[model samples]
Target: MKSGPDDLAIHQKIQISRRTAGLLLGSCLVRPAKVLASADPLTNKIVVRSQLSAGDPGRLMNVFAKAYRGEPITLGVIGGSITVGAFATTKENSYAGRLLTWWRQQFPRCEVRMVNAGVGGTGSMYGALRAGKDLLSNTPDFVVIEFAVNDNWTDGEAFEGLVRQILAQPNLPAVLLLFMMWEKGGNDQEMQANVGAHYQLPMVSFRDALWPEMAAGRLNWSDYIVDTVHPTDAGHAAAARFITAMCNNARHADLAGRSGATSSLPSPLHSDAFEHIDWRDAAALDPHENQGWHLDFDDKGVAAWNAAAAAGRIAFDWSGTGLVAVFADPLLDPRRIRFRIDGASFQTLDTLKQPKRPILVLAQDLTPGRHIVELVDDDGGSGRAAGQQVRLIGIAGIGLKDDWRR
Candidate 1:
């Protein structure tokens, strides 16, 4: 894929020690913080009440009820650079972090857990595939999804599938959809809102609440937003305020402390292709590589195998269907890479195409079973005497039938 303005990748530090890297990878969340917004909240005509499209609040209210009972609650957030705290600097300064702080403040007695599963430069297609591995694995009691900026209108099914996957969790976690916006006003809310409505979910929009202030000259976009997509701390704080407003509604309006209400998930909006998806990070897979290949890290510090010659090789195993190979443009070179699934003939893919990320569906309908996959660098031969390259990031796939609905 080609790197451009849209790819506002949050490049994590790689030179840090393993201990520091573990925290960066979200192994363990830090303690409660006194982190505050860098600037004061601005006054505007935007209505917080109107910004919330309340669907069935049964599940959300349950979370509020549980918290009041002093029970533990886990909060999860997944998205792109914005959710990962791009321009906000630290996680504690992020909108997600601000939301977590607001939660602790509301219920001081309850123990709240946080899982920040945001990897920059990724959209819902990748989110759907990695949600299980990252967010759901923590068994969060409540989750916030904020992919509005990273994903486009065409990502409806993948986004819907991500929601279904989280809702289908055995623990019955509550899902909240959050919509962020661009400096000039653009987001995936219209398309994403369709999925939210179908499932009767609690949805909040920062754009609806704050865009008018920018458009009407009541608020300067430069003062809040960092660039085209990422937001400054004040921008993030404004968005956090919208989320807290919804949470407050869930606590007070969704029936003050009594909630045993149950709700069934609606049928699929498009296809349930992502409900059982899983991602195999390059680091965890420990792929075997040739001498011609050098190891690297993606923007998120996840392992990436960089091929420097045609003889470079990478081999790994992945199961089920909807198989995808995620390539990291470590060198940003327009090169070719070839691969084979289950010993099938090698299929060639040219890297760094114009618009999309180098995420390819190697096999969309593989037989539901384990499969062997291998990649051989298709750059110039080992003796080419050139160091140009391509990098293999991670591999993901949908699960098998016996793996349950999720």
Candidate 2:
């Protein structure tokens, strides 16, 4: 993370096509995250200078001013497993939970509300798809986004889209970018930092502080992580401190300078396709479509069609220039996922070779309008339909009717 936002690489001058713009401003939906709760034992305000990047504290000025006034404030966070408190002894021991504790300490008189919209094994694409419904619906005044460890695909288009979406919220929330790392020091923080720098958002990195220590044998990675990715209770505490310091930095920022954070949303930092999106899960499908579909949670308890081959002729309606579908995981064997737009020719998605939560872009650049989709359950017996073991997630579109596709 950098201390300035004047990166020559900020190429948001590129414009989004009119058709793509229309695809935005619709409703969307996706899985809900486990609410973040509990207390953090470490109360000391620790600011690791190396881990802190002031970026743009513009939006945060108002948040701190609100805290100083002892006014109520709302906070929202979106991220993957680590943000979900994975590997922590308890949800409260997760960094999110600890931050909740820290916020209370700084402004005891100000009531703080939090919405933890963290899901396991998901990334910016999923975050962008569901953020409106999951995180922004509550109208948070401050938001934290952590996807570096999970946004394995795309350079940063999806990440940029997610950031832009949050900034576009009416609340004008203060946004913070958080980057977590794997034990081996592998992560997408560098890629994600570009988006943070472009937006001049405050960023805190746990890897910068701990990774070198681990390399020098001064800090035992196992002491902070029981696995290669998820952090241990100690690890969560370590991360929470940097976040606390960043918050302090924002609180102490020049108020007059930060007042300008409300500048008009910039042009496409990358592609705006993800800027406005709508996600539809099985819950949004016609009840009659449930005939062949057996609704069941996956091993991780995420609601999905464990056996969609049983869901006969499922259907739904969407209006957009593009559409996509999310599947639970890679197919154990070669398979096909078949669907059609407006009853047009069937589009087939051969089973994904990607890892968990593989997505298939069903269609793109189609004429914008209300289009119905029909999904068939195929038993893989030399058939044109989707495979029998198909576990269908919900469908999504770029345009829709409803808050920007909730």
Clashing pairs in 1: none
Model 1 Cα lDDT, one tens digit per residue, 81-168: 8888999967777898999999998899999989999988888878887888788889999898999987773457678889998998
Give per-model TM-scores. 0.78, 0.79
Best by lDDT: 1
Model 1, residue 384: displacement in angstroms? Answer: 9.9
lDDT of 2 at 243: 77
For candidate 2, the per-residue lDDT at 152 reads 66
How many steric overlaps are in each model, in order?
0, 14
RMSD vs true structure, all candidates: 11.1, 10.6
State the C-alpha lDDT per candidate: 0.71, 0.69
